[model samples]
Target: MPQPVLSLDALRALDAIARKGSFAAAAEALYKVPSALSYTIAKLEQDLGVQLFDRSRQRAQLTSAGLLLLEQGRELLQASQRLEEQVRQLDSGWEQRLRIVVDTIMPWAPLWQLSADFTALERFTRLQFSEQVMAGTWEALLRDRCDMALGLAGEGVNAQVELHLLGYAEFAFAVPPTHPLAQRVATTPDEPVRREELLAFTAVVVADSAAEMPGRDSGLFAAGHVLQVPTMQAKIAAQLAGIGVGFLPVHLIQQELLTQQLVVLTTEIPRAPVPLYLGWRKDVVTGQACRWWREHLLNLPWQQLLTPGELKAHV
Candidate 1:
């Protein structure tokens, strides 16, 4: 006899039974009778010339061959679903991709969750993310490098660009436990440490991501040695290694602070929380994906969203 052609229905029946752990449960989930599911499974096994189930057990149990088929069948089913979703996405007028620029200081825990949710929608809109610092986020938008930006400085507000207030990020002055500043803070926490002492150590600063636009130097001092790193994570690592000392976002180093890996020092110049903004060009026509992001970000609670430790738990 010619080999029987397999169908999605048969594969689906097998997967459901394996996942649900019993024929009765699988039948209920598929909204079919127990006998119907059993028939499908039996037909599939016969077509493949294999005994799929060991019927001697009280509960439906798969044989070795049955488990192999079940594993492969689940993968096939997922691919089939993706194929259908891509078709639907083509039918809709969704954008092919979205480019988002996120500032280095922006907490990424919530953004990661947002990306996961977007993927679940199966809109087929590819998300491209790039990291920037300070002015670089704004420069990306102005250079037409990104569709949207988060944690941008408020300077040079464009009339054609829409801005959303994302609240302030508190910057804490931190150094490794072995750093000179950490050792010098013998007095009460309220008393200001000399600025000259702070200027003595090298400061770890993140390089701006801007290309054409003039980059910014936010925390650098004239007298101090400068260690310019490419990213915020690098700066964090550098500070932890006692390479330099600088202000870091409290949200990003909560764990370090709690573990005593980094010590907060009293400074004559206390860095205030920096206010960040979300921005996108208003003149350009936006696709559904862009609109979705704008709507979500505009309404997001900045304080809760930017708190890394709090958001990481839920993610």
Candidate 2:
């Protein structure tokens, strides 16, 4: 019996044809003549003893076998690229890629600014951003799927992971400008309702465990109607729809506040802001880009995010 030989070039040609949807398009992308591409596919079909594509239409459509082969081809190609990247990093003496996993609830402006600055240095650095729930983001770092994570500290984060306190993000109850809460006086209203009073009405909260405001454990949330939502955007939408009062980051709702779409609750509820931290594996030495970002985040003037009293408490 004779063993069959594998044809990598033919496989590449088939992969390109499947991706581009036509021999002409694949040829153009691969910088090969259409005849050459067709020949490669023909050879591939012969070697596999199966029809890879249906030729009835002007465009190429993958047969069942072709679809399976294309899926496997993509996985193989990705693995090959990862191997090549690792080898290239070894040769260069430093890995230039920075993989970051962050909580979806964090403010976007600072993060975007940091990313722009890092890439502007032109240091061969690549940035990968993974937006996940709080616990999910920490899991990514612990599993070695990401280099760092930004979110609240969580249980089960590995001992090897170092936590850097970035600052605190205060949580506030926001309502529409015409809501009754806005009509109340700012200085502790007479007969002030407890924090849980808002929950007597509909309370829209970030459904994800990671994005939830801290201090929820306080008795204020014990007996109230609660609606769980997945993202900040969804929570805002629900609030705008008058579904319920929502706990949201002040920065996220600044535009809404300015537009009079939302107003802060003046009830005597305890205000507990969440502490933000940047976590990374302590054993792993950070790259130049990651280190630069860590320093920048640490030095940010948090006073912008805190009120005078809150700033005094933090200091």
Candidate 3:
């Protein structure tokens, strides 16, 4: 007998079933009836003369042979997608998708508005957003995981990377109005708090998003306790609740400062204004969608992108 020839549809059925975990779910995703999907998988298994999924499990799970095939099949599918995308790009210069990695410190409202405007252009490019903190922003761009990076902290000096200065943002050591630090600052307005006093309280810091890479500490005591949260918003909330005190981007908490909800603490070591940059890989040719986004961001004033507050006056 001749060797079995696999069809793309059959491979897709296997993938969908594996991805969705059940034939019923996969059928819904593929816009097919459950029975049809089941028949397709059965036919594929019969043709290959091997069991793709173990019948005992409630969820569609791949056997060792199935796992091997699925791994290679995904690569083949991805290559096919790339080929199609390239052809489409040749015909119309718009990219199929654009991935942007942004630092969580940046305000989201303006970015969302910009994305809405981009969508209005009808360029048919999908926008993917990933939030990264500190070094993770740089790492995402270097690893080719993102097409563009916004609000990056430091200079990435490499021939393959292109960097542009966004602006500088000042960070303040803010504490809740009811906190001891705030009360002390209110009473002793002229004196700076000692490091030991500051260390006595827990520091609220945003946990770095980097995987496998070493994370950086922005404004936490070296020997003190910390309450690590996933996002910058959570950090601010923790600080507002008097859970912990740490450095926060001034623009992010301007409203709270104006309302005296959060008070700034004068510390022995005042953090210098951090400079942010926009970075993209120089190696990859900037696609139409990416170029459009870059131009749009470059034209936007940094002050307008941040949360509206009297940060400059406070700093």
Writing each residue's lDDT as its tens digit, candidate 3 over 1-315 gives 987568778778888988888888889999999999899888888888889888886665789989988999888888888777667774787888899998988877778879989989856688999999988887898899999999888654667788888788778888877888778877787777778887688988788888756887656665368888888999999889888888899888877988988877777878887778888988898778999999988888885445345442212
How far does residue 252 in candidate 3 sit from its true spot (Å)? 0.7
- Residues 187-303, candidate 2: write the lDDT tens digits: 444545466566567777664443333323211243367777766677788888787775666666777777777766644664666666788898877666677777887777644
Off by over 4 Å in 3: 1-90, 303-315
- CA lDDT scores, all candidates in order: 0.80, 0.68, 0.81
TM-score versus the correct structure, for each prediction: 0.69, 0.59, 0.69
Error of 2 at 81 (Å): 14
lDDT: worst 10-residue window of model 2: 306-315
Choose 1 or 2, whichever is better by lDDT.
1
Best by lDDT: 3
Candidate 1 error regions (>4 Å) = 1-91, 187-190, 305-315
